[model samples]
Target: MERGTRSVVRDRDVCRRHGVVGVLVEPRSQARCAVVVLGGAEGGLHEADAVALAQEGFAALALAYFGSPGVPSSLVDIPLEYVFRALDLLSARGYASGSIGLLGGSRGGELALLVGSHDERVGSVVSVVGSGVVTAGIDYAAGRLDRILATSGAAWTVAGRRLPHLPYVVPPELVRSIERDEPVSLRDAFAALPTGDELEAISIPVERVRGGVLMVSAGDDGSWDCVGLSEVAAGRLRAADHPYPWAHVVLEGVGHTIAGPPGGPVAPYGPGPGVTFRYGGDPVLTADARAETWRRTVGFLRYTLPRETADEA
Candidate 1:
């Protein structure tokens, strides 16, 4: 797509040189900044969102951590070093280290927070329906319903060591419902995870993030308590007196799966193979929320990671 006089370009092999699976989108004109876009539990490239961002003049990479060729098939023990390689790819493309941002949704949102907290180079973060703490990994290929539970295994590792994470204690009733292909909300399972001091070990250190943070969540999220989780990170930032801007917005009527470019299909709720996933929201309200959220996200990124002038580029 063309943005003004500049045509946007998509490069599928740029990240491959850095040992990462991703698609890079950028305007033919020098990009203003760099952004890494991540997908949630669905696990694949978010190329559409990256392309949208590129149309807005930023270099955007839709990165795939798992469930893709050349990567782990599931979300188990993925190394943070791989993410670092994505950053390296952007850096090699001439984007300043301080101008790079991270954007993600759902489990991808959790990953964004974790990566931003650990990497000082991240200039900004936008998490939609994400968690503030590390959660156990999901094994999609596991036959038993319980094997796919959040408590099954670690999702990420740093320096080859597993990161401490919150393990969901799934109730037997919920397991039975899931097995029966009944509609089930996992919010209770997430809510039942430990709190207070118990969370200190697994909670993402949002205060350590080098730049602004924008977290958006659905109040009626059926998958997890994202509003509460975003608040936890916001609280950390406030307590630390973080210099950069940070805001958490709760879209009152929506459910999980709220992040994406606006004006797409708005199926607020859906049923998976083994269970009916309850993504709660009125279609009209969800559509409005999606537009507002995307606007704010773009504004937040523009403010935090400003575009470069032609001379600077």
Candidate 2:
């Protein structure tokens, strides 16, 4: 199957566990069935992006773990176990065999790593601005609060909008729970989350995983320390002596989100300090970078995905 627009299932219940729902999207062709899980923090799938993947010959499934009000969309809210449940559901549906691959960004990136680490079914993964383990050094929650306060106080502009102060604080109750380790602390859970250790601890048959990974990062992802997360993940991969084919690319002058070059169609930024160059909502790259990265990602997938090898260009 080649690139073509076709209908695929969307927003359908794939599975449920612990009051969380796993939504699925099924691609048209059975020749290759691959699911791309979205980051809970980013909400739902962009209809355009979903369609694009289907056209590219993938059974792209955007699993929604959060985004529902009060359900906890932040990395802290959802447990790594939820991602595993989504993977399991797809496996039961016969989505793919040998190993499953997952894609995630921001907080979702962390979740993807968690799933790929513990679940043997995960074939490969692409984590955009994600971390291998959640540790106390990051202080993500506090960092988020600090950034919000700083942005509020700074003089910034975006698309003519004045800098905005984002005064947000985690609910006190949630904070209390985290401190008490009631149930399980998010940081503790994340640090303890299985995946980044030696392959023995990781369920995926890494050597068999063809594409391995594509880790991408930006200069200023929305998070307080996106760079730290990226670095930590990269370090883990190296420490583990990962043998699978993998590449890590950190784009300069870009934020957590992908954006086009600064002068051309500048990506929309929120009104806040550093907002002018903070996050990106558009694709950014020189023709060469764009072409090369695209080629690499496609080639990597083609080499890794079992179906792609059988269908050789």
TM agreement with the true structure for every prediction = 0.93, 0.61
Clash pairs detected, candidate 1: none
Model 2, 1-313: lDDT tens digits are: 2233466555443444323454455566553656555553445443344444555666566566554443443333345565666666766666555445677666566556656655666767776666543322212233433343322221112234332221234455534543454331122112123333432332222223233766666554444344555565666566667777776787655544441112222343433221222344234543234344334545555556666422342
Q: Estimate, for each residue in 135-177, the C-alpha lDDT of model 1 and write its tens digit.
A: 8888877754455774368999999999998776778888888
Candidate 1 at 50: error in angstroms? 0.6
lDDT of the structure predicted as candidate 1: 0.84
Relative to the true structure, how large is the alpha-carbon lDDT of every model?
0.84, 0.48
- Output the number of the TM-score-best candidate: 1
